[model samples]
Target: MDAVQVVAEPRRREILRLVWDEERSAGEIADRFDVTFGAVSQHLRVLRDAGLVTLRQDGKKRFYRADREALGPLAAYLQSMWADRLDTLAELSEAAERAERGEGTDT
Candidate 1:
């Protein structure tokens, strides 16, 4: 799945958020979820495929961390979408205010 798909899943996003600042071992992440370690591992695999997270082998443990650059596209996409919607909503609110004040014209 793509980054968008990966992040859309709440569980996967939680995992990403947990590891956003620091690397966490797979076991550590699994502990936060209600599911089993295997389930968390599947979520991690999806995030890995989307390039939103990377894994490293530290001795006998597997550590995962967020990949900021890999997530840049998702950030840009969300920002642009919010910007457009916010601009439209602001314009509508202003028009509503003008109509309420008898300043808006049918023409």
Candidate 2:
């Protein structure tokens, strides 16, 4: 699958984020999500097939890290997009808090 298609899934994007900075064991990555290990493993496989993540095997454990070089321009795009979303979410949360406190109501 192409990089864009591979990262279109939310879980795959999250998986990329998890391994962006450092290599992590498959089990470690799976622990962060609510889904079953099998699901996470499937995501890992997709990422591997897309060349977006590098895999390293040590003994019986598998480690994964994001291959930023493979992502190329998509890395910057994803970062910008995620940052914008986070900013919007934070604004919404703050507005909700103000509404709860009766501090920003127009009425």
Candidates' RMSD to native: 7.6, 2.1
> What TM-score should be assigned to candidate 2?
0.84
Over 43-87, each residue of candidate 1 has an lDDT whose tens digit, in order, gives: 998889888889999899999998879998776664465578789
Clashes of 2: 0
Measured against the true structure, the TM-scores of the candidates, in listed sequence, are 0.68, 0.84
Off by over 4 Å in 2: 105-107
Candidate 2 has an lDDT of 0.94
lDDT of 2 by residue, 45-74 (tens): 999998999999999999999999999999
